[model samples]
Target: MKNDYLFKGEDICKSFGSTQALKNVTITISRGEIHGLIGENGSGKSTFSSICAGIQKADSGKLYLDGKEYIPSGTVDAMDKGVSMVVQEQGTVGKISASANIFFGKEAMFVKGGVLNVRKMNQEASRVLNDMGITHIDPQVMIDTLTFEDRKLIELARALYTSPKLWIVDETTTALTVNGRDILYSLMNRIKEEGGSVLFISHDIDEIMNMCDALTILRDGVMTATLEKSEFEEDKIKQLMIGREMSGHYYREDTEESIGEEVVLEAQNITGGVLKNVSVSLHRGEILGVGGLSDCGMHDLGRVMFGLTKPDIGKVQKGKGEKVKNAKWAVEHGIAYISKNRDREAMMTLCGIKDNICLPSLKQLAKGGFILKKSERNLSSKWAENMEVKANSVEQFCNTLSGGNKQKVVLAKWLAKGSDIMIMDCPTRGIDIGTKASIYQLIEQLKKEGKSILLISEELPELIGMSDRIVILKDGVLSGEFYRSEGLTEAKLIQKMI
Candidate 1:
């Protein structure tokens, strides 16, 4: 007998105004299986999954649960039917305690009559965290105090607590470290063993191939193909997903010459929490890539260099000018940072695309003690067009844009500022191949213009492809450095990082 499908979507059609986001798409997820969704940017993967999780309704589709016709009005209705989604952007209140945030909506589980049961909530939260192997976090600690990776784990734990039969993870692993990813993978295996289903979405093809039983490809809002494990080939999957052959060289060629004599930025004896006695120099017209396993202090180094965090005993000197010790100082000194968490640190969701793109350049665009709307719009329009930001217009709100477009808008904002020094933290976290190519081109252009960039990314291929020099950090120390000219390999970098 054929296996019973836990969830099925047929003839799904979704539209955003005049744009058809999903066109006649159909997908079936069987119980006790992990279904991997692979697609390029703008490919209706997120939209279809969102519809499955009842975050949005499709224009035309028939959904079934246990072979029964099902249509949910909203997320709450979906949750009632044992469907839940952990989105890429964290959906938790940061100022609240972890326990409070975990059980925010389900207060009845921790509330008695008119009083809140803090101890019960804490106990339940602790149990959930422990089950997920998250030992560093305390239930009573504020969510704001936790790292991005930890907060994401907390979100996963919350989703698991819902006892979801079908769990949708949308690009959730981009923030997680190796250990955190392992925990999630183990949980997924357990969930599968317990007869639960998962819709796994990510840009990392290797992870999908390793963990998923089947793969579904989407492109231009259309379902292209679905392949079983036996038919899975990385190149074929890429071709079907993007409708084109993927270049093996995702990284840039090391055709650029050696660094010039000018030192654009330098950090000496930097001693911050998780970063000890670190020193590095960034030259003009060079891309300096920082890499390591998560917890290697590279992230903290980026934060410190961009002046987001203070260093205990270090100085960031720009050119021959004064040293920067804070974010404001970095900004004033023509230094900009694109954070790994684009939603939280980069874009303003409630604002318009034009506003988001021009935000970093407001001072430059101001005139006569007043903000110049025309200049802002013109500047934003130029960058939007150049960056190929897919939006109806600059007037469109950023929250309505896709993940890739939002990232481009963030990059446009910083590029509009014309910063001499840029510290990009995972700028392509959830972007598609096309957008990633565009970003690489932009970086190349910046390098040609003699700008200095310090790139901190988790994706090793990207670091290898784009950096003129790769710096590997391990346990709060600079463990190794490789020049692109010297032919660095993943093995060598991993060896140093570990």
Candidate 2:
């Protein structure tokens, strides 16, 4: 058993100001196995993984790698000690080439005579990306030019370049598409086959069951259980992680709710990005779901509908024939967009919660052409409390919150604007099951209030469960459409997606 173990964290503990993230948690990962770490948001999974990966330090505890005391000064030091991590949020820096990002910390290898060998770095990066089964990306292209999923693949490529003995993937799959996920799964399997260990964290239980040989559950910063493959059970694991037996269905039970006949939003002959002559409409008081393969243009459709991206030769119009001009226009006209790229596009992370929530409603909260702090506090406080954002106060920094909390802040900002037409693109991505339920209930309530929602998601189950009508996009075209029915299934939806 000693020889089988590759890594161990003994009595690990971590804290942030007054909050205890990890409380004397202990875990171990054996060689050549994918070990899962799962919990609700703020359950200290990322904190522990980051500590092991040397992005941060545990306040008190011990870490052993290969039966040796391991202490890394930083991420680069960790990589040198045979550990690498792909973080939960975007890790790749923008404004640089993908090649530059892949060899970020190891630039000394490509530098000689006070000059960096750009060509050599590109060649090596190209090789690493191809080896990881990511061939579509150009190594020389700017990283920001790529989509969110492609950037995640780049992060995977960066991790693969290290060829570490242990890899820590922190909730990374939430940003990937189906093809990207397949590539990631292949990489994890390859690592195990080559006698390497992987620490995989995700909110998705089914994924953990399918991919991990063993899993450790956490709740409120304490280790709940460490179960082997034979002991893996969905209900049991969920109960342990959340500390409660999940009683009702995750999604809304009502499937036969009627939607208003009025068409609130429409995309007419839209053709841009990955979309080609696509047309769709959102009815008043309806949840219109868009689903497809990870590059099928459904995400782009959401952006276009929200006026973030202008179509090449088409128009997005409100029910009253008002052309959706741009983001400002969309917001002013009671249309709100919750972007899939939450960290970058949705809320301002560096800013406080009050500012983020009150941003879109600035004009509404201002008096005499001056925005008062009290008005900001009042409006932000109301929505923050309504959204149940767990933070010290409305003035708390957005960056300090957990993934689920950050998502709630994003939703709070939009809801504070009092927008009736909501375009939520992967709104619940990377969130825990508990938060997902809350958001689902919120969506249903919004629908009841005559709000139209254009829900764009990669998860078929989510689309089938929440949408009044589901549309599938395949290779930049609308392949099939289905009205919500008892017979609707993921298999039926997948057939059209592929």
Each candidate's TM vs. the true structure?
0.95, 0.96
Winner by lDDT: 2
Which one is best on TM-score?
2
The digit string of per-residue lDDT tens for model 1 on 336-406 reads: 99988888888899999999988877888889889988998899999999888888899999988888989
lDDT string for model 2 (183-275, tens) is: 999999999999999999999999999999999999989999999999999989989988999954788687674679899999999999889
Please give the lDDT score at residue 106 for candidate 2. Answer: 84
lDDT of 1 at 268: 89
What value of lDDT does candidate 2 attain over all alpha carbons? 0.91
